[model samples]
Target: MIKLMKSTFYKEEETKKALANFILEAEMLSMGEECKKFEYGFAQKQGRAHALYVSSGSMANLVLIQALLNLGRLHRGDRVAVSSLTWATNIMPLIQLGLVPVVLDCEKETLNISSQTLQSVKATDIQALFITNALGFSGDMEQIRKWCSENEIIMLEDNCESLGSQVSGIKLGNFGLASTFSTFVGHHFSTVEGGMICTDDEELYDMLLMVRAHGWDRNLSAEKQRVIRDKNGIGDFFSRYTFYDLAFNARPTEIGGFLGNRQLQYWDEIVSTRENNFKRFQNCIESNDDFLSLDVRHMDVVSNFAMPAVCRTHESFEKYRKRFENAQVEIRPIIAGDMTKQPFYKKYVTNESLCENADFIHKNGFYFPNNPELTEEEIALLCDLLHK
Candidate 1:
């Protein structure tokens, strides 16, 4: 029977072995040198100047919002344009921080917030755009970046689903002011449960460090920490227990760090396998009139998080849903479906017309397993069931 995800970790044996070694020899289990090492390696890989480790991807998004607010890059009640086809946490932080969210529609072709959607907002009050590279599919980011710059809009990326994806030689996360990644169990990499925020902005990076902890100066560099302590008129001993700003305890453990380092070693193999599976899956459904698949051929690399299948009609959805279920394959709605349909959103969002495409996707779109661990035979069998 085919399943959505086989296990928590892609390379379970190797991951457990690494964790075991660290557990035996590690001096401390808290967020420390190991977390620092993992963060540095992740930053280098993503081509960012800094990376901050957190307990979960949800926390990564939350801390990023706080960091932006703390640095005055964004303010309370500012209108933040968000993808209507995003996860709950992506919008939750915006609401939690008292920011107004203007839900943007997704392109039917890419299933992402395309440049056209950005232009359709028509709201001049939009100070920021928090976009999600949904399920490894990205829109024309180069054009979007140019537009954001011209309009003075601060762009942030929720790249939790598109970690290894790239477009025209440029990485997706690099186009925005700051971007986030998740190493959740079913994600591209598995550190059990962990997340990262990457950015080139030095001041924003410093603030993120404090935001991940309890807004303490301890995580900051000695020079920076000293400056804050001196400015606050607090001595070294007293500053050790001081909380400087609004934040949360979202730090990851050493075990999570060790697993991340080990998982990164197999990065190429993992991505290549997922991409190959994606192509094979696409080939199987290209001729099937019942389904509509997004065109991702333009993407230089695609680290597919899941395979999205948009049924042409409600009848087709029921037919395919039954087939997959009978075959023991799992399925799920696309990224929590339309964000506006969520219970929490209904209370805050009144104008549903802005999310037309998102509403269409929510009604028609569903995703299935696209993990790297599937063998060629397994992939073929899964495709056969899908086509049947």
Candidate 2:
């Protein structure tokens, strides 16, 4: 049976052996050197000033929002626009933090919010945009970035699914003020369960470090810790236990850190294989009349996380879904289709307009595996099923 994820990490045997060795001699299992090294490497790879490792991608988003709020960049009741067809965690933080969320529709082809969608926001009250680079597919991000800048809107990305993807020669996570990444079992890289927040903004970076660790300066640099403590008039004894900001205990374990660094070594090969599989899947689906393919012309490199197939009709969706099931192929709905439909959103938000294209995707889109470990035979079988 073909599965959504064949292994936890690309080099599973190596990860297990390394972890086994670590279990024997490791002195500490909490956040430490391994986590620090992983953050540094991730920041360097993404061309960002800093990267903060956290417990999960959901925590990464929560940390980012809290940091921005702490820095006075966003305030209670501030309107934040979000792609309607994104993960629930991406929008939950807005409501949790007392920020207002305005749902924006994504284009049917890209499965991401377009520049046109940004322009369609008739209200001038929207202060920020949280765009999700869904399933490794992004809209014309450069265009969207320019528009956001002109409107004085802060743009952030939920790049959990598009870690290695790029557009117009820029990495997906780097196109915004800050972006979040996940390293769950099914993501581009696996740290078992870990996440990261990457940004070029030094202030935001500093805030993230504090927010991630029970809102303390413990994770901050020695020099930074000294400066902050001195400014707050707190002596060393009291400073040791001080909570400095609104935050949580979202720190990653040493194992997550060790695995993250190991995964980085194989990043290139992993992404390349996924991209190839995406192209093969695209070729098969493009020739069939019953499916609609994502528009990837604007993407310079696609680090495809999954192969999404938007059926032309609900009947077609059922037909393909049953075929994949009969063939023992695993399948999943595309992201968290139409975020407004979520119970959490329904409780907090009132009278949101229909995000038409997002709703279309919610009703019709489903995805199958595109993991790098897929064998040639598995690929041919998947493609043959798609062709039918």
Candidate 3:
């Protein structure tokens, strides 16, 4: 049967062998030189000045939020606008850290919050826009970026789903001040389970380093570490045990780091395969009037997380769902559905604005597996399932 994740790693057998030898011969296995190497490599590759590796994508979100708070960029009661069509962790950190969330509805075509959505939203006083690049698709991000700059909004991207995606010659994650990524098994890049936060801002990057560890200056450069110690009057001996700010132990191990290094080699191959498959799937959808054709023409590349089919009606959704089920192809709801409909969100956040488009997509949408590992035969079967 076809599955959401076909394999654990891109070059599965080779990575496993290398990891076994590294573990057996290496003296240390905790977050060490390998993790640092991966961070440097990933930052350079992703076109960012700094990249902070974390334990999970969820931790990446939490750490970023904490770092923003520690730097006084975001406050306890400030309102942050987020796309209604996003994963739970994308919004959880906002609520968990005492920031009020204003859910912004997405466009039906792009499945992401467009600049038009920003103009239409009732919440005009939002301090930040925590936008999600949903299903490897983004809105008119260039115009959105200009609007954010003009309005003085702190924009951050939850780019977990769109690792290799690009728009207007710039990567999706680089559009915002800082962006977060997931390297879980099913994502575009896999490190078993890991995450990354990329930013060009050095001060925020340093704060993120402290937040990833125990709020210490251990991960910083020698000069920066000395500055923090001298400013806090923390001597060399006492600094080792000192906790300077509120933080969590979200550091990744060498295993994840090693796996990331191995996976980074095939970013181009993985992305191209997924983008080609997505185009084929899009062609099938265009011919089938039962499903809605997604708008991704503005995007230069789509490292699609999964091939989403949003039917025009619930009956149509059931029909397509049955076809995929009959073909042994797995499918699931689109990224945890609407954020406001989640139980955790409902329990914590009340008086939220209605997200009609997101709610509609939640009921009508299901995503087919579009991983880079899909064979030509599997692609044909998926395409057939998507048609009629």
What lDDT score belongs to each candidate, Candidate 1 first? 0.86, 0.90, 0.91
Name the runs in model 1 displaced over 4 angstroms: none
C-alpha positional error of residue 206 in candidate 1 after TM-score superposition, expressed in Å: 0.2
TM-score for candidate 1, please give it: 0.97
- Candidate 2 lDDT, 1-388, residue by residue in tens: 9999899898899789988898688999899999999999998888998899999999999999999999999999999999988999999999999999999989989999989888778546788999999998999999999988988899999999997899989989999999999999999989989899999899899999989887889878899999999999989899989988898889999999999999988888888889888889999999998998678999988887888899989999999999999999999988877788888889999847678788888788788999999999999999999886
Candidate 1, 1-388: lDDT as tens digits: 7677777787787677767887999999998888899999988888999999899999999999998999888999898998888999999899999898888888877889878778777647799999999998899898888889889999999999988889998887889999999999989888889999999999999999999989999888899998999999999999989998889999999889888888877777888888888888887877787888677866898778898888888888889888888877888888766788788998876655457777777788788899988877778777887674
Predicted structure 2: lDDT: 0.90
Model 1 clash pairs are none
Superposed by TM-score, candidate 1 places the C-alpha of residue 46 at a distance from the truth, in angstroms, of 1.0
Model 1 local distance difference test score: 0.86
Q: 1-388 in candidate 3: lDDT tens per residue?
A: 8998988988889889999998999898899988989998989888999999999998999999999999999999998989999999999999999999889899888999999999875445888999999999999999989988888889999999998889998888999999999999989989999999999999999999999999988988999989999999999999999899999999999989888888888988998999898889899999999998899889899889798989999999999888888888889998766788789999999846788999889999999899988989999888888777
